[model samples]
Target: MRGAHSTADTAVQAPPHWLRTLALLLICAAYLQGGLVKLFDFGGAVAEMQHFGIAPAEPAAIAVIALELVAPAMIVLGVWRWLAALALAAFTLAATLMANRYWDAPPEARFMLMNAFYEHLGLCGAFLLIVWEDLRARRARRDRAMLAGTKGSALQ
Candidate 1:
């Protein structure tokens, strides 16, 4: 029985693709909700932008909403996922720095603001990991194709 398969071995196979899709959905839900809320409450979003001291508040709100919607969708669909991840990562970083300026907050608010800042930093790191994985997969596929091509030509 040295070479025989075990139940644990069978159970150790890779997870189904749907699990990945589900994970992507969960990861994107926040952005999707934010985008939809902003779309429905455009005036409120603009006001928030003005509160943040973003010039051209209306236009900035529109752009932020658009990016929040489109980028997450792209990532979920695996369509230009790297670019989407990069965009979202950059957006998260900027928003964190601007909105979660913990040092400027009063002592009572500083703790919460600091937590939000760190959470956004964690999100940015996740996005970068996604980009890295995507690039690694693409390189692996390209390398496999090249190897196969070389093998085929050699056999000819």
Candidate 2:
């Protein structure tokens, strides 16, 4: 009985390959697409930011554009994902604040603010998905190890 494998021991295997691939794809695509858009039409984005009460449009626009474009690539490659996520999350938070600050503007003028809030939520969701998948995979690996250890001990 000392080395008997418990039910919990068999349940903790790494997550299925497909799930991990799907999660990676979804996060990469969403983040990369947004980054590309910001990078390509940067001037328009700066002008829009000005409309939202952001001052000194040129520098802010340049910084945000760079962060959006580069961070997504870093995150997708799984190199410096945590840092990229942090930067992106911070950017999203700023956008949200900008949006709220202009909430009382004319309906047409508020579109950017609304879009910023939605995009921020989407990025946050993607980050959470990556974290959840990572956790599941780790849990599964632990379970598999536990089962293997139990079985080996029983045979000794």
| Candidate that would win on TM-score | 1
Model 1: what TM-score?
Answer: 0.88
Q: What is the lDDT of residue 43 in candidate 2?
A: 77
Q: Cα lDDT for residue 81, model 2?
A: 65
Candidate 1: which stretches are off by over 4 Å?
1-14
Shift of residue 11 alpha carbon in model 2, Å: 4.4
Candidate 1: which pairs clash?
A: none
Task: For each of the candidates, give the backbone clash count.
Answer: 0, 2
* TM-score (all chains, Cα) for each model: 0.88, 0.58
Could you give candidate 2's per-residue lDDT for residues 84-126 as a string of tens digits? 7667766667676666544776888677766766876777776
lDDT of 1: 0.91
Write candidate 1's Cα lDDT for 47-130 as tens digits: 999999998999999999999999999988899888999999999999999999999999999999999999889889989988
